[model samples]
Target: MEISQYSAEQIATLQAKLEKKLGPEYISTRPGPGGGPKLTYAEGWKIINLANEVFGFNGWSSSITNLTIDFIDVHGENPPRYNVGVHCITRITLRDGAYHEDIGYGTAENVKQKAAAIDKCKKEAVTDALKRTLRSFGNLLGNCLYDKTYTEQVKNIKLPPVRSSTLLLDVL
Candidate 1:
């Protein structure tokens, strides 16, 4: 999506705020099945809260627009595995009444969890879709994680120790 000049400015401001609030520890790195490192969701509520603070309460929203499920036998097991995929749309309404909407897609396979395969797959797909949608917002919310080099670099960095006074519960 083409971001307007105003939106770009807002995003830059938000990026600064996010970097100050969240540290490298908030980014997760995992080895993909193919041996390449991948960035995974470590914490998502932080992004939601930051977005609310930047855009105002309820200024942003996301919804799942489509979902599909397929049963496949990866291991030739008796019980087929369910693979779920979802498409989601997220929108942010700017203060000036203009809006930006983005679409994200995600897929998840059966996790071997009990009888809750459907539920688990659905939840995983939704979370992945939301993460992708938020990443489309740019560098503010861990989009840099998409870069393998960046992910490798940050994987070893430690987050600063939290001071008692800076704790969210303490602030509350």
Candidate 2:
């Protein structure tokens, strides 16, 4: 969430890298308003959704119904950086073709403690959601950057352009 720690270009590059590594079958980016780039959560979900998409083993639709991430607050006095973070509920719903029949919800706050100290309720919400989704749905996360499968998958992918920054490496 610390914008000062990373340039917008760095963020874009990291996102592009993730997309390339993860494959686009179950992931895609939503363009931002100013044409600057895609939103961060939109970028992050390329892997997150892919992981959940494998849940069809039990007759449940395994695709994310929705996902949202946003900068909740900025902390630190001298740095004036983004510290506190929140993740809006990233939802995965079971569907029957066009009509969704069953609903299950997970939030980062549901697993991790809400960032009461930094006011990062949303960030907590996402972590919690991911944890709960994995627990409830069984670990179905497919080839993701962190997944062992991704290292091999990357070789098959053509890397995309990106800016460099350690902040972007935090998720790794």
The residue-level lDDT of candidate 1 at 56 comes to 69
lDDT of each: 0.59, 0.40
Per-residue CA lDDT of model 1 for 66-107, tens digit only, reads: 655544334325665555554555555544545445555555
Cα lDDT for residue 155, model 1?
67
Q: Per-residue lDDT for 32-57 in model 2, tens only?
A: 66897543222336435544443234
Query: If scored against the real structure, what TM-score would every candidate get?
Result: 0.62, 0.26
Candidate 1 stretches greater than 4 Å from native: 1-22, 34-42, 72-115, 161-168
| lDDT for 147 (candidate 2) | 48
CA lDDT, candidate 2, residue 104: 27
Clashes of 1: 0
lDDT of 1 at 105: 52
Please give the lDDT score at residue 3 for candidate 2: 29
